[model samples]
Target: MSLLAARDLAVARGGLRAVEGVSFTLDAGQALILRGPNGIGKTTLLRTLAGLQAPVAGEVAGDDIAYAGHADGLKPALTVAENLHFWSAIFGGPPIDAALSAMNLTELARRPAHALSAGQKRRLGLARLIVTGRKVWLLDEPTVSLDAASVALFADMLRGHLGQGGAALIATHIELGLDAQVLDLTPYRATIRPPTSRPAGFNEAFA
Candidate 1:
């Protein structure tokens, strides 16, 4: 069955339509990759999917989603263990230790989030999902600053999540190796100025 589905969705910001006539269905163990020019509304569509942005039209229906953005929202003062505990408690999920270990965070359990490098922090943020056990994951730029190894680890986690009947909606320029259908929103544009020629330049929509 589909875990998340958006029907005839339309979102407008400041009287400008960012996404119009958008729709799709993401089933358990399936993923949907959203690709488009920056102002075309990748993040905006994510917000709407997570119920953070109200759409001007259309319907988004599904269970609760695990939402992660650019920042990862890690607390600097909290240790890796504490951060997972706090997030798990607030979000309600399964055991966190296994998740942390899977992300290779076993040694840094007691380390403060601020002390970890950028990649480590992102891992910690992702570990929160292992604890919450949410079936629907909405990840934005999940591979932002990670090294090759960490990116591999993240991909492993995502694969595991999907194997266990979970679904994901990711907005990323980097490849996740998951067989995802890229929903590009550029075709709906009435007037996309200066037409970008670069490859993988989703932000050109805002130009």
Candidate 2:
């Protein structure tokens, strides 16, 4: 069975429908990339799948999903190791040693999150996926702020995840050199329509 599946999914942005009629399935040991121009609702779609927001229509099935968005989601006062440990505890995941090593964070284990560079912080955020112990990953622009070498490191980690029977749905512009399928959101773009009610302050422009 697919680890995660979306059927006739319709997601909105800034209170307006952005993409619709989307359907896809991700299975063990597989990865799928979301492709489209900006303002096409890639982030909005991911947010919907991650359960951060509700979809306008259709359905998303399956669970055990971990989502990493543009924000690092780190606590500035915490050290790298502490952040990983905290996430692991919350997710009932494995120890931090492996995740630290995978993200090349072993050397910065003791450094506070606020002290790290942007790329380092991004890596730390991505590392949380390792500790989540979830079977499916939904990532949006995960490579942002990552240097080329760091991007390679992330690609290796993603490969490891899939090789171990985990699945991923990623929205990224750069190529990660992974053997994965691509799902273009262009054809799913919604036409102009009256605005729909969204959360009090949500805006798709920044999503």
Candidate 3:
């Protein structure tokens, strides 16, 4: 059976459609990688599938999904172990020890989340998903700050998850050494409208 399925889905941001007529299905032990350049609605689609946003059109069918967005959702004051424990209580899945060991975070288990480097924090965030025991993972740029070694660790963890009948939908620009069906989102890019009334020099203001 399919773990997650989207049928002719349409997603929008700020009242403008960003992904239209998109459909796909993910089954157990399967991974789907969403590929596209910036501003192509990859994040928007992931958010919609994660149930963080309502689709402009169509339907998404799934349950027990863990969503890790661009931000590593961690408490600055909480220790790495504590953070995973918190999520475990809410989602009722694996043990904290298993999760920590899966991401190779046992050494930093007692350290405050704020003190960890970018890669450590990302690992902690990924560990939270493992603790939840959810069957599906919705990841957006999960490898953002991870180095080569950390990326390899993450790939191993993902493989273990799939081995246990879990599925994943990932949005990333770089390859993570996983066997996944590639979804080039370029063909689904929405025709975004230009800003209506910005100052002439506003484009370069943030540059």
TM-score of each: 0.88, 0.93, 0.91
lDDT per residue as tens, model 2, 1-207: 999999999998766888999999999999999999999999999999999988888999989999998897899999999999999999999999999999999999999999999999999999999999999999999999999999999999999999999999999999999999999999999977444644556566432
State which candidate has the highest TM-score.
Answer: 2
| lDDT, model 3, position 102 | 82
Worst 10-residue stretch by lDDT in candidate 2? Answer: 198-207
> In terms of lDDT, which candidate is strongest?
2
lDDT (Cα) of model 1? 0.82
Clashes of 1: 4
Cα-based lDDT at residue 135, candidate 3:
95
Q: How much RMSD separates candidate 3 from the native structure?
A: 5.8
Candidate order by decreasing lDDT: 2, 3, 1
Residue 39 of model 3 has an lDDT of: 88
The reply for model 3, stretches above 4 Å from the true place, is 192-207
Q: For model 3, what is the C-alpha lDDT against the true structure?
A: 0.89
Q: For model 3, where is the 10-residue window of minimal lDDT?
A: 198-207
Residue by residue across 1-207, what tens digits does model 3's lDDT show?
899999998888776777788999999999999998898889889999989888878899998899999887799999998898899999887789988988899999999999999999999999888988899999999998899998999999999999999999999988888989998888887765566654566443221
